[model samples]
Target: MSNSTPQKFEFQTEIKQLLDIVIHSLYTEKEIFVRELVSNASDALEKLRHTQLTEKEVFDDNLTLEINVTTDDKAKTITIQDFGVGMTREELVENLGTIAHSGSKAFLQALGESGAKNSNLIGQFGVGFYSAFMVAKSVKVYTHSWRKDAPGHMWSSDGSGTYEIEEAEGQRRGAKIVIELKDDCADFAQDWKIKEILERYSAFVSFPINLNGKRINTVQALWLRNKNEVKDEEYTEFYKFQAHAFDEPRLRLHFSADAPLAINALLFVPKENTEKLGFSRLEPSVSLYCRKVLIDAKPKDILPEWLRFLKGVVDSEDLPLNISRETMQDKSLLEKLNKVITKRFLKFLEEEAKNRAEGYTEFYKEFGVFLKEGAALDFTHKDQLVKLLRFESSLTEKGKTTSLADYVSRMGADQKEIFYLVGPNRASIESGPYLEGFKARNLEVLFCYETVDEYVMNNVREFDGKKLTAADHADVKLADLPKPEGALKDEDVTTLTKWLKDTLGERVSEVKPSDRLVDSPVIALNADKFMSPHMRRIMKAMNKDAETPLRVNLEINPRHAVIKRLFETHTAQPEKAKLVAEQLLDNALISAGLLDDATAMVARLNKLLESV
Candidate 1:
């Protein structure tokens, strides 16, 4: 069958160095050689697929475009054969015998400089075929080019320094790689091991991959297909297979982008947050891919940290991956990918919030905490994240919520700031004195029940040009309400406030008549502009020094009966007025969550009771 005597050729010096690097230090996983060989076969098949379109006649036209992997545990040999485009003797020497590509040469220089720790540099140099040197004591590649006129050839190498090529008889139309597994890497010769590797790395390959004639890649890479043609059941199936989740995804975003970098992404928001369900914090689940081959299963940098709840695949043909395709080389491109995918998902949420209010509200109920985290931490998307924020407000029914944009739309022209009150529940915030003034003036105050809401508000600072002002802060200035009839004279109000401030002394920052209080007898506001009550609580819980005691301004409603009586009692019974003033201050402090030690307040309350 030999057309001429077998010819032995020394590997190009760079190929020798590359072979040494690959065999000694380049790859961490020896089994990855299977992946490399399979990928090489796939590339050959893909090339032939393109070739068939342009050429009129093709050799072995009836041969199916599929990969067949046969493992022989007994012989300790694994053979992967693809019935696609094969190489001629000259092509094999050119492709396999030398580092013909400049990229591969540069890769070798990088590997040499880095001491061959860069396993991620494998596929970049067109040296994916040489990875078999990692596990193979000897590798034989029998290939017949896809042209009938091109004769069959066999290239053999021990991967030390030289290889041999000779005419081969009765060959097929594509390449078949036979790896004689090394004694230490005999596991790859097992059927189950190869099947698992194929399932992990090549499950979504465009061609059928058969393990001993049984098809393994049963699922398609649905993200690559036109989404309209993919059915709902198909997408659900793909999600289940890709995410390994039993429950269905609550939402899905299937989109493709052409600008900046070509991206095809299919992201899914699960039915429940596993972390919220008492599971550990979720890791990034979005897999990264290039041309249907997986790059990284859990790409840490492809999406922002808050998007860890998302599960899906992001594929970009434009990504410049290092040789092994394990790590992405272009950081800016990855950031662009992150931005594009995140921005698209945000736009999708915005659309859902506007067009499907109830669905978005339900989603917000489950996943809004993540959005709050992004709004507080991710400045680039803060504006979009703020719009997606939802909260119960003074005007909404107990369970109902509204967005900042919606709140702004309902804002009175005279209103210059957005108001929000942080508390445990709707009833608590409404029952408290803070909301009484806002309610009286018909100013809607957003109700924040979760702890992160205040943090989000502080960082967001403003939305649509309206300052996000906490209702309890002393700096908040509500429009003055009309003074009702029977209100105390200005002189009398001034006298009562001065007497109360003097009695309270250091305990109160300022005691004054409130222009905002209506039905409430007294309202409290935090005087420290820098620290809100919630922030103080957070600091205390964290054991961080507050550095200053909480100080608050007490505002009295002169129209209320308590104040009217206090004004008279202060002149008649100064001691009793003192007890009442201390009691009022304690009550206000309790409402504001600033009361650290309440023993004195209890003693004061008993004394006031004796007077009553």
Candidate 2:
């Protein structure tokens, strides 16, 4: 039943070079060889399954369609057996020793053209089998073709140019590759090592995978299944398994697309934002998979950095990857995958906001910072992200939030801008002088509390064709409200403003009678068009040079009692009035979060009290 003589053959010229690259320099991680071998087994099994539908009288037809892996630490040998379609002697020689029809020629040509920079172009040419030599001192493939008449054969190679093939007795229907591990790679023969590799890259493969009689890939690839058939509990289980978290997901998006790269993505937002809880910055967790085999576990470029909080998998069958399957060969296709997934996720958020308002609000409370970051930095999705931003406004009750679309809906027909004020919280913004003018005019101003809000608003710039203007900015021009009785005369208001400007000198860029102040004596707006007072304070906190000379466009409410009295006191008591003017500027600076020193204000306050 066995042939005593073995037929020996030299490897094709290109295959010799390929073996050198694959064995010596191709893969960054040696463990990738496990994934490649298992993926090849899966492909073989899949082919047999398709063939079974059309053909009859197959060899080892009674054998179950699965992959079996065995590791022997003492012997330093690892064996992977697939009970699927096997190979004939001629087929083995053609597949393993030659490059004529295996596409290895084109692969080598591409490698030569791209040089070492593109050395990762391995898997494109169906040479995944060569990866075995990376860890093996010698490799043996015992196979029997599925055809009833085909005989069993064993192909052996030490990966030094030539390989030997001989007839072997009692072989199974599928290929069984036995790798005699090199001394340095003996760890590959450990059961735990191979098990870990199986669970990571091949866990979601269609067929069952067994290691030492225990099933490894028990969890199914739910993303590939119909959404209607997948239950909530099943999704939850899969999420916990994939994300390695105990807490349930807050939101899940399970979707697939045919066009734009045949994508099947399952993304989850965990119940808690770990980064919000003061944990270390999150890395991208959405793994990239091609045909159920993981390409990258934490692919940095799969999604925009702002979306790092998301956890799940994005599998595309259309990826054009190189040999190691380590790096994607086509960058534009990867970008397309990013765009498609991002837009779909954004659309899901919009639907959730529309149909489940309360739930979306809770999610926004925990994860809104990420959206703000995206809105500020990701220009491609800025418009959609801006619409999803929610904030409390003068018109909404405290704790209630309004979307930009809702805010735009409530805007007066003549209102030209969306006004917002940044402060530490709602109370601080409401108490600030800037809100009074908008409140009196019945113009709603959004309350922005987070540190990133200003940056988001500044970058988003506009929504619904209305500019996003900071309420306290110097350039803001609000609709004038009716002047109440007992206010200072127009002439006196002008005189007081001119006198204050002359008294304050360089400290005041320009003092003017306020159209935007209703009840407060004064409000200070940063005169520097480039930097807001809030931004200046942030710069100072970061220890950057924010000490550009303090100059503010001070606006005084003519109706306030202090301003009316100051108009009278300036002419009668010039020294006292000058002290009052300086104190007011400092008060405004403190309120604007721009005051660097309060020593002068304290002295001025003591003098004013003594006079009183």
Candidate 3:
């Protein structure tokens, strides 16, 4: 160290303006300074690592390549030391005192042109290092050039207007920034505060980060690694760490993409769905990272709302963040990113369903609601999401599931539409009249148990070129089967339907002989094309005032014993037959989950018992 005297220099005009903006308005959160500084240190280390491959004679060759953060609450001081490529005296003047190489000149120009409200432009210009002035009272940068002959120097600034530089002794090969914390920002000097900030934003930095001699970033960025080399246990551990979850992941998708946008994503489906377990609605848990540095912990636009159940990380190097690195500047690019990740995840599900049927079935049982939501709402991925949907069908064993594609493949050439029935469970759906004719004809029908299943079906509308038809809908048309022995004649069936419609009055929209019923006495189909019985019930449960009046197309099976008896009793015992007709409509309503009041049915049943 030759010069004992310090040399002073004034900051450039742009630097002076930048200091004011950064100190007062650049970042919304004051603690972002720590992330900015740490990110810069990691960048320097990465550059040095690349340089090490070519240069043999590096200064301080024995120093470990790591970042150490020390905090002293007693003295209100925090120091960040990184053993990476440092700067010389002239380089410090060029880097810190002027706006030439730092891109501050352009940043200032853009800031002035667009005004402070348009701050997203700040990120396009590199000004990360100056973010430290947000909380620092006085900043001291002690650095030594990586070149062997370069001397150590200390650059001091209070970020007012000017700075001083002086030769120093015993400085390391890299930069060490000591920040004298302002009185209002003294919390930053606390060990716990810094540790929290580091773990939140800098946890996945390529270089090791140590806070107060304890490692902060221990978990690796598994998304960026080759899938074949990563162990299953490692994935589980990473999922638990990233998701803050205890149970092992039910499914994991770790993938990388180069085209469209360079992206690396590690997504996990938790072992249990918390929302299904009666927990509060899930928020978006998949965090967004830019080059391994966390940009947003819960980025709302990163994924569709239906994918809120997923937990993990999505890191892309192509992201251009604003000055605070808090939000992305290019919205179209972000949308492209969303499309890519969503399509890739849906593709991953397709592969899982094809190659690992049992495991996919287990995942579907827990997380299938989310896929259904996506299938109903996200039109961009509806085809793929619909393909990933699983359902128990009349053809499959209990608890077994089939994909839409598989269901389509099993369909006979004569079948023109996909058939499904919604009820409380497999037993209710099987016992219901809606599935009888399909079962009699050996036609498979999907059994939907959840309330959302109807809405999903209604929105998805069609899959694999076949219309998704509700078996209970009045519009359904089934092929005729051979008339069973002892069935009502066509003339008697028409007369019975007309008499029942007159007896039931407005309760029945239109009574007719059914082709979609084989053994059941009668079935109630919703008359309204827009609202099904199940959907009406759902609306009533949510808001009673929202419920609409019920109108049904009652279809009676001509071949069933009850219908034959009703046909016979209509003219002989008219009052007794009226009671039977009312009771049958109520019974069908009960099976369809459309019954609002049973008082009338109870009184009618008493009258019928008296007549018997």
Candidate 4:
């Protein structure tokens, strides 16, 4: 090939095909073009740094190792510069124009049978370098080799058909790439935007990354440092920077594992949940890293969906990266890594719960939903995450909460069930008749306020050898205490229950003395196996045309004044007794959240008010 002014080179057939795929579909986010280019520049600088250590007479030894980013808004062009190993005219043609120079083909060719068998890479197609054409109309790379006599050269390509190579004059000993962004992608031409993309993807690059002469990646990758060498403030700063949060982390787990898979991780629970404030569902925020190089930000498979709230970085050394590091192949290995790290983080939580009770409580208030989700959805860690849960219980003071372990610790030997009640607040639960028998037995029951809590307990089923029982369930049995003085006589009470059942007829499943009554007169119990009060509410709310039928256990406390009087007044005045019984049942139904027809209850209550 003879060149008069400059030589234009056609890409190898394979590379041309690879370039088309890269420019069209290799990346999901167009901004990745910037990161890919910056990473290449950083790699060149890193190689030059290693070369300077052993080489006595290095070319352009005086040049500093730094990355300079300049954005030209007027020209809609962005430039990335690094003082690293560059290339000469022929080197530029061989390096930038072909895929063989990347060391990928030979590495794959020489890949040992066992090494190739290990499925731990993300990219292998050798087209990641061509991703720049996704958002750039044209790219110009100017580079000078490290050799003293090597002349600087410029490589220009429109990324359409061909690229040109020519000798450039007075170029520094590094690589400078200029990208002319396409019209729609002009946002990269702003200095602030480039700085953000650099900080997110290349913040841990071994060398300094400067934007418009100001240092951008100042924070060191603390995960790579020795645990003792990192100060607490540095960790906090990293957490704030990575989490995009202002408050100190309520909990932090930082550790390293080497056997199963070499992994270093730093995780944090924020001070508050913005989602709890009625914000949208949170997306996964943990970043996956291989040797401090970001692989994927917000990777879905790295952690379970239940861990979406946790924020931090996980740097793994055993991660066999594909060329681009965009995805991973060895899922079983990734699962192993996930298991090890998740277990360790949970163990850290356990330690925090024991050693830092107050701190854990604060964190629980914010991130407990995540644990609840884990308990309900992640069967692999359900038992462990269940133990990590905390809730306010009858045993704990108001505003204080008790964990499942604590509740189990306080459980009586006779109590085989871990009882919980879903309600709007503490007052409503305490005043409800279902709790009377439980309270009389001095049994502690967890109080759940959110709709998801019931769904969680229902899914979890049991924890630590005790069955998780809903305190409001009609089937839950409480020990019957001795009848109070002035209570209805046994024979009369029996006759009255029989007649009330007969009178209420189809509306009543069973009219009987509740085994769990103390202060309240009567309570309605739902006997439907499939539909809980909560499930009923949810289903009814969702379907406007569907009707929810009422089927409940009408329970009577023999000792309560209202029930005692109703028993006596029933045979003496059958008509008024009917009204009084209906009214009493309505009042009980209101408390139990079973009687949907509140119009009738309201009418009866008003009538009774007039009689009074």
The lDDT per prediction is 0.84, 0.85, 0.85, 0.77
Determine the backbone clash count of candidate 4.
Answer: 2
Q: List the residue pairs that clash in candidate 3.
A: none
TM-scores, each model vs. reference: 0.67, 0.68, 0.67, 0.69
Candidate 4 overall Cα lDDT vs. reference? 0.77
Q: Which runs in model 4 stand beyond 4 Å of their true positions?
A: 1-67, 70-207, 211-219, 323-327
**Cα lDDT for residue 214, model 1?**
93
Candidate 4 global Cα RMSD: 12.4
Q: Which tens-of-lDDT digit does each residue in 1-612 have in candidate 3? A: 536789999999989999999998876778867877886787677556645645788899788889999999999999999988899999999988887678898777666655665453343355767888989999999998888899999999999999999999999988999999999999999999998888766766667899999999964777889999999977876675456444688888889999999999999988887667544467787978777666666677878899998899899998853313334567787798899998888888888988998888888888999999999999888888998898999999998888888898989999999999998899988878888889888888999999899999999999978999998899888888887788899999989999999999999999999888877899999889988999899888889776478989999988899999999999999989999999999999999999998999999999999987
Off by over 4 Å in 1: 1-213, 323-327, 544-548
Task: Write out the backbone clash pairs for model 2.
Answer: 121-323, 122-323, 123-323
Candidate 3: residue 290 lDDT (0-100): 78
Q: What digit string (tens of lDDT, one per residue) describes model 1 on residues 77-120? A: 99999988898888888889877642457667655555543445
Off by over 4 Å in 2: 1-219, 321-326, 544-546
Stretches off by above 4 angstroms in model 3 are 1-220, 321-327, 545-547
Kindly indicate the candidate among 1 and 2 with the higher lDDT: 2
Q: Candidate 1: which pairs clash?
A: 120-324, 121-323, 122-323, 122-324, 123-323, 124-323
Q: Flag the better candidate by lDDT, 2 or 3.
A: 2
**Greater-lDDT candidate between 3 and 4:** 3
